[model samples]
Target: MKSITFLTAMTVAIAATGAEAKTRLLVNCFWPSSHFACSTVLPNWVEEVERVTEGRVTGIIPPKSVAPPPEQLAAIERGIADVAVMFNGFFGDAAVGPKVAMQPFVGSHDAEAMSKALWATNREYFADEIEQVHLLSQFVISPAELYSQTDTPINSLDDLAGRKMWVLPGPLAEITKKLGTGVVSGPAVQSNEIISRGVVDGHLGLDPQAVQAFQLMPYTKSTTKFSGAIYSTSFSVFANKDKWAEISPEDQEAIMSVSGEVLGAAFGRAWNEAAAMAEAAYADAGIEVVDVDPAFETALQEASAFVTEGWLKAAEAAGIDGQGALDFYKSQIGEMTN
Candidate 1:
């Protein structure tokens, strides 16, 4: 009887210790819960974490974002959330490494390729810039195109400048303002407010999926596509440093087995599928898809030179070989495309 009682006590104690050792992570989503990144990407990663850790590590996302879009990284840094996604633009001049992915006419429309390349480049050159939080993965959406609600298609800079345009903040806004366009800049989620009220003549920084997701197709009469992406936004997924440290080293390696380039490619594939759906929706919505004129494309590329030059200089200041990274990124995209 004494032996049986001792064994039972040991069993109970071991079970309690196992429970105590399990880690539950709080993941926050800045976009609406229904947004693919929220509904799909983060949740998928959480599942992978649980699977790889054998249920020792798990995660849950709050119904809504813990903070505003621009504040996501700060929230993670402050430990308000264990993990979150952040736009590179929110980093401003503090980190120029991401700008290599944002340069005009340099990125591919393939989200997966660009995302993998971004991760590769980050690991090789920009790893030091991610000091505030534990970097997990990087991703970019499909390239953005200029869309017009007005009768006139935005085939030339004059047409764009003639109308007040709603553009995504960061490089696109700066480029438009430099080219003399009347610009209103904000997060993509807030685009509907101004657009639905006729506050702007057109929008300058949404891809097909974003247009469909934001319900902008009804107001869009035409969209102009460039030979190369006009611009693409970069995002970083990261965890709170303290929270990351709490995980066992074994579990950390297991979690990362599904992160980095693997996670990036997963995000890219999702975007590619979504954009394809949005393209079909564009046809059904009767949104005219206009090819950019070669001469105007050249002129616009020339005008956007300052954005890239500024990025190169800023990257150099950060001790990264900006040109080499940019060239490598482009080459990676090309190799993947071919």
Candidate 2:
């Protein structure tokens, strides 16, 4: 028994050494190193990939991102980074899978379930729409709600009017614009500076995790939530095409075997847990949480009409089953959450 144990440990050490010798794929992460994406999601993913492959592959994140948040995809595609995370919405109408995932009221606050649904939807109906890169995993992060730092709270649809709001680009921006708010488009990472400088009166899509991650509690004092998710943020992990091609097919399968929906579900669960923490933080900060009436929901659906139509139009242009994809995604979420 002692001899057998020694041999097994030796074999494991040899495998680890072999994997450690392979060219470590550089993972360019745009989020702060303290942020969960850098600290948890990406790191955990790297470990999982290496472990599942029995140390046949490995990866690492640089000290900082090689490019800005919006330019991550371009950097990876250009081979400036081997693997990277990207906000799908950064590509606008060109990124249909993300647009589909961000559609209003399509998901609930269960980030894990929503993420799994998004992966399933992408695999079945929207993969071709975003196959421009070698996709490793696809995901979304919230059932986002409204947050404010000013005197006027966003309790009603009309309250949204004329407020200069910092919003993420993509369908959420269009949807907010239709509600009569002026939008300042930027990524969530910049929200602290924008809100502090008074660049925008409030932000439109502040999720609980975001509020906590960015220290938004000091700036924001009120919250408005919809019964269902107002909107969600889309993300993807992808490899540079050439870099992906360099991996042996066997290793590719080993890498992919533990990615996609399984990894996406992890992000969902992590975000959801972080959101719970934010809620506790909100309570300590005296942030007033408000739930809108049914009337507000009616007005929201009417106000945001073009967002879905725009997605479908873009989908048709890309030959994707736009409505079908939407239905499939929602159904998957429903199944998982239920």
- The candidate maximizing lDDT is 1
Cα lDDT of model 1 by residue, 1-338, tens digit: 99999999999999999999899999999888888988998899999999999999999999989999889988998889999888888887767897789999889889999999899888888987978789888887788989999877899888877889999887889989988999999878889998988999899888889999889998999998888899998888899998999899999999999999988898888999999999888878979989999888998999999999988989999899999999989988999988
Top candidate (TM-score): 1
Q: Estimate each model's TM-score.
A: 0.96, 0.88
In model 1, where do residues sit more than 4 Å from their true spots?
none
Clashing pairs in 1: none
Prediction 2 TM-score vs. true: 0.88
How far is 25's C-alpha from truth in model 1 (Å)? Answer: 0.8
Instruction: Give the per-residue lDDT digits (tens) of candidate 2, residues 176-290.
Output: 8877788988767777888878788778777888877787788887888788888888788888888787777888898888899888998888899999988988778888888
